[model samples]
Target: MASDQSTNPPIMEAKTRHPLHQIADTPTHKLLLKQWLKEEELILSRVSHKESQIDSVRREITQLYIFFFLFHSISLLLLFHASSSSSPSSASASSACKRSWIPSLCALLSSLGIIWAVRYKSEVESHLEKLLEREKEDAKLLRKCVEELKKKGIEFDLLKEVDALRRAKSLRVESKPVRKWSARDFVTLFFFSVSCLVLAMIRLILCD
Candidate 1:
């Protein structure tokens, strides 16, 4: 039963999105289309900006972790080598060398910072998803309105402009996939924090 549950996790229900009303038969169809097109433009703009933010935050966090990992790995090696070559008399001093607290404190702070950033990343992603879903819902209504306008032999200038804007080189969504955070991501972060803290403690152990 447990294995089945794990293999077939229940799918989450889609959240309700704010809907755009279709009023294609009305005399004010043009006005409604114009308002909706403007709203669609705003949604796309925000999605683009938020996606960029998520990318930036991810890169900066990855680079910071790499920096700390290298610094501590080298420190551990040098400290170990120094302890091996030192005489018994200086053992006490060498052991005292292990009491270094700066790197450990910094590691703790970095771990905290990364955790916080990961949370921020999650929030941004959730917001982006909501925007995309809302856009999809609105698209359905917009298309219905367009079809009605077309059948009536009415041409909408705003609709044409919006379609052009959507096809614009700058505004269009790229082909690249948006990366999702997974269990592996969380594990990697946990391991990084633990490994750094352990190494710093090893330096302290060397002193004793």
Candidate 2:
């Protein structure tokens, strides 16, 4: 009886173990984890690309606005000198009036242009800020996913953090070193200033 019992297979044991054994080596849980990783990757990619685009647009808008401001500023200054030295005895009143009115018109137009540009730039900046925040949130989520995968005894790419670190390092490396101003640079600036002064004097005398 003892020998027969030892030789017999327990029927319930095989049934109970089959399902668990099938899943233990290659679990459905891991597949779910992999799927989650893919989703996270997709989200991260979308957000990052959106952030890059926003940054590019913001840069362009800022450059254009700055250009507009500088151009108008110079025009206003030149007009001021022309208006200052013009006198009834020295120049025709009609021409002086025209010159004065032209500068004023330019001033008004430039003011309006600046206002519009600033409003547009502000809107774009706000959108870019929101995108930056969204990217930050996505980064946090990616970090959490990596941690959870670690807890699950799973391995996944942690390339994002590595890439971020590399970017920071590259930025540090690419920073320009400030050099002492050379004599040539000083001479160039001096000549430019003198030229501007000469032009201003000429305009003043001719307008007068």
Candidate 3:
């Protein structure tokens, strides 16, 4: 009887063992896993790209703030000097004001800079929000895929893998290095400095 039982497995044993045994090694499961892995890679790549874009936008915003501060400082200094009671300085400042449009030009540039910075910041924030939403959706889909695989009796620990990926992404974000100022930053600074110097020279000439 025992030999017969061994030769012909019982119905319960057959049912239980058929679906669970070697399910992960089957062709269908292998194909599913392959497709899932590809999707995982694509999502990871997109997340990385979005993070880089966010960093770039942040740097641009920082530059805008620096520019705003610089312009404000110059405006304040000009105002103070122009308002001085000293005869020579006041006379010079008055002459410069009459001959050149430096104050108005600076004000206009400052206003434009502020407007552009606010607009750009809003746009970048919106884009970042969309990317974050997409990331959440991708993570949800990955979890669902993992659940489906689990139901199919594929015993691999894919949920753990997904969680690990998420943790790694968080770590990367948390540890993001400060970016060095780029050539564009230097160029912008140089241009602003040169413009200010020219304006100063014109004012001095008018004063004389």
**What TM-scores do the predictions have?**
0.50, 0.49, 0.57
Q: Across residues 171-199, which tens digit of lDDT does each residue of candidate 1 receive?
A: 54545568887664785677566666665
Clashing pairs for model 3 are: none
What is the per-residue lDDT of model 3 for residues 52-134, given as tens digits with 9 covering 90 to 100?
88877878777776776687667657665654543566766676569567665765576566645645675776579577667
Best model number under lDDT: 3
The lDDT per prediction is 0.58, 0.56, 0.63
Residue range 101-192, candidate 2, lDDT tens digits: 44455455555555556556656766766766655666665567555554543233345544654465356432345877754346345434
* Better TM-score candidate (2, 3): 3
lDDT of 2 at 53: 77
The parts of candidate 2 lying over 4 Å away from their true place are: 1-27, 77-91, 153-208
Which 10 successive residues of model 3 have the least lDDT summed?
A: 168-177
Q: What is the Å distance of residue 57 in model 2 from its true position?
A: 3.3
